[model samples]
Target: MSLFPTYKRFPLTIVSGSGTTVIDNKGKEYLDFVSGIGVCNLGHRPPHVQKALEEQLHNVWHVSNLYQIPIQNEAAELLTSTTNLDYVFFCNSGAEANEAAIKLARKHTFKEKILTFKQSFHGRTFATMSASGQEKVHQGFGTLLPTFEYLPYNDTKAVQDVQDDQVAAIMVEVIQGEGGVIQGNKEFMEAIEQKCRELGALFIIDEVQTGIGRTGKAFAYQHFGLDPDIITSAKGLGSGFPVGAMIGKEKLAETFSAGTHGSTFGGNPLASAAIKATLEVIFKPDFLQSVMEKGYFFQELLNEKIGSLSVVKEIRGHGLMTGIAIHTEALPVIDELRDHHLLAVPAGPFVVRLLPPLNVSYQEMKRAVEILAEVLDQITDKTINSD
Candidate 1:
């Protein structure tokens, strides 16, 4: 069996990685800016994460939720203390975390409808895909879990227009990562909170991509100063290990009794160890502050170097999760950057997304900016000469 044919993968076969760089099968070193789609916050093979996993491997790996796992309790405590949420339901990926959140909202409110915004992406699960505002991902998935309504993002009026008491929850992403890294306006977020309160709907924030310090804040929702009834996190939670969590207020979390939901490998010993180590590192004041500083440095350098290029349109997003909107398609530029030993991913048709490791050094940032500048100059010169 030749692997499942799903992803249109890149040509290089990455064999190993360290810090913010990866080595392909041919041993070519490339700086990794995608961070495994915002999962590897501490970069590849962080010593603490590695040591924790190594130590756990010898002790025990899996023990179903049937038994008591001290690590699980520890992970939950660490996570809850870091955010406003009260409890955590650990799972394996962003989709599972979102699935739990959806279930919690429905169960808590005893309602059916869910309100999401346009250009939002929650996850790939059936319910999440249904809740997602992007049509392309839901295409052919066939009538999804019912009672989901999509409204225009950042439009308070659109949210206000939805008149449905059956609305169970309002799910949002403070920074829409897949939606070209657009951040929801503060007023827009406050408006949603107000509407949720008015309509008695649970407010949910999908922080899978923006959580765990990707947005300079521990959780992107904190930046808006708004409290959400439920929150989902995954990407960087375990720094490379698979771990997702649905966090909710104490009362809301209690809505799901024993059999209502459970995952066999969700909070296994090894995963918990990874989570603990990652949290210890990412939640540090100095580390997060550095991310904020580096993020500013990166945005400034990017704008200074290529912001005026004819092919560039705009730069948007906050902290480390940035998107560059270009006048031309971003795929060619992404591939070209790979040729120059840099890596980036395309967010939308015309936008290149950057989710570099939170600990990326200043020198690395300078190198990345220098390479991007050179590439943009070449592309511009080619276009001019052809004209």
Candidate 2:
């Protein structure tokens, strides 16, 4: 059978990756700045992640949740302790985590209304896509889940105007990854938290793309001093392996009773092993400090090189999940970077996103910046020549 033609794939097919570089089938090397859409936090095929998966292969791989899984317990312990949350539920992907969070919120509050913000990308599942504020993704997906409302992002009063006891939860992204790397305002987030409290509604933070060490902190919510009632994470949790988790306060988590929700592959031994190793490496003081330092260094380099370009409008985002908004469509820049043997992704129509591996070296970052500078110059020269 032919493979499904869903993705608009890049010209090259990557065969292997190590650290921040990937080699295509033709043996051409490219610096990976997108980090598999921010899933490869520790970079591609880190020794720790590889070793954990290797060791688990020698033992057991799949054991249903019907029985005890020690690795799952270890991962849960680490996640809860690191984030200071009380309970956790493991799933296979970010979409499932968000799905579980949605169900839990509604069940616990016995309310049907969920308030989300504009330009937010949650996940691709039926309910998650419905919850997502991006109309492009929701297009063609039939009638969405009911009682969901969309409001302008960063508007506290808009949220306050609709909040009520019937609201089950307010879901948000601390940093909107697929929505052009826009960071949420601190005041707006705090106000939403306060409103949720006042209305007895849960506040769910979808950190699927910004969690782990991507934001120079364990979780992006920590930066704003706002604690979410429930937090969902996935992309960086397993450092490439598929894993997702929904963590919450002890009382709030109780709503999920036996048979409430489950996944066959969630928290499997292999994925859990990867998650355990990823957390161990990322939670280290030195590693996290390096992430912060590198983020500043990269942003400085970008500002120095392309910040003043006529087509470059703004540079936004924190830590490694950065985006550069250009006056022109970003696809041309993305393609130019590929020609220069650097890989990146477009976050939106005018934003070129950079989500290099958290462990990306200073040297690699410098090389990427140089290449981007060259590409920008070429684009500017071409535009001038045409004019």
lDDT of 2 by residue, 232-351 (tens): 999999989999999999997568888988989999999899999999999887998899999999999999998987778899999888999887889989998998999999998999
TM match of model 1 to true structure: 0.98
**Whole-model lDDT per candidate:** 0.91, 0.91
| TM-score for each candidate, following the candidate numbering | 0.98, 0.98
- Model 1: residues with Cα > 4 Å off, grouped in runs: none
Report the lDDT tens digits of candidate 1 across residue range 1-387.
489987888887899999999999888999999999999999999999899999999999998889999988998898899787788899999999999998889888999899998899998888889988998889987788878888989997887676778889999999899988888999899989988998999999999999999878889999889989989999999988999999888887569888999998998999999999999899887898999899999999999999999888899888889899988889999999999999999888999998899999999999998988898888888888989
- In angstroms, the error of model 1 at 68 is 0.8
Clashes of each: 0, 0
Clashing pairs in 2: none
